[model samples]
Target: MKHLDINQIKEIIPHRHPFLLVDFIEDYEPGEYAVGYKCVTYREDFFRGHFPQEPVMPGVLTVEALAQVGAVAILSMEENQGKTAYFGAINNCKFKGKIVPGDKVRLETRIIKRKGPMGVGRAEASVDGKIVVSAELTFMVGQAGKND
Candidate 1:
């Protein structure tokens, strides 16, 4: 088992700022599974417009969080470092409960299968031990090209 702080996570996944949904990875097993967290806060940029009076973390962001966790799980594999994970598809995504500011979301992801450069994963987001969102995420790992 290994743990990934934010800085280490930055080396595996290329997400930043408002787009970087996972705060830190709590635990990980290369090519197997990973757990990460996101702490929702009132100060978030989206909260201001999402709803001023009733701030809630958007469902889409929850999915993004799940993807981030899945990415960490896959990239941690010894064969994948320095590569990039690209969103391939999402399936069976369901939002079960409202996630508001101040909620600490725990994201857990496990790899379901892998073939060549593509992998499939399942992930869930929970709060207080209750599931808030769940989905199957598919992604492709490949060499990262230089940004234009």
Candidate 2:
């Protein structure tokens, strides 16, 4: 298991500011699972237009955050290093609650199946111990420029 800060996460994934959703990785196993966090604030760009009176994080972004956590688990593997994990599909996704500003979201993704460079992860995101989102994410790992 390993704990990763923003810089460390950058080394593993190609995401950058304004897009990198996971702020910190609490702990992660190379190819098994990862637990990460995202601190939502009123300062987020989306809050401005999402609603002036009520700022709710978008459900798609929430799902993306969960996918990033899963990417950490997939890309961290020794054999998969330097590879990018692309979303193959999102299955059974559900938004059970709203995520507002000031909410600290806990994201987790566990690799439940794997075959070569493709796999499925069981993902969930919660705030204050209450689940807000859950889904099964399918991913395909491949070199950045080469299609395979």
TM-score of every model versus the real structure: 0.94, 0.98
Off by over 4 Å in 2: none
Per-candidate clashes, comma-separated:
0, 0
CA RMSD, predictions in order: 2.0, 0.8
Residue-level lDDT tens digits of model 2 in 17-120: 89999999999998999999999999999999988899999999999999999999999999999989999999999999999999999999999999999999
Candidate 2 has what TM-score? 0.98
Residue-level lDDT tens digits of model 1 in 9-128: 998888898699999999988888899999888899998888888998989989988988988888878888878888889999999998998899999999999998898999999999
Poorest lDDT segment (10 consecutive residues) of candidate 1: 139-148
Best candidate (score: lDDT): 2
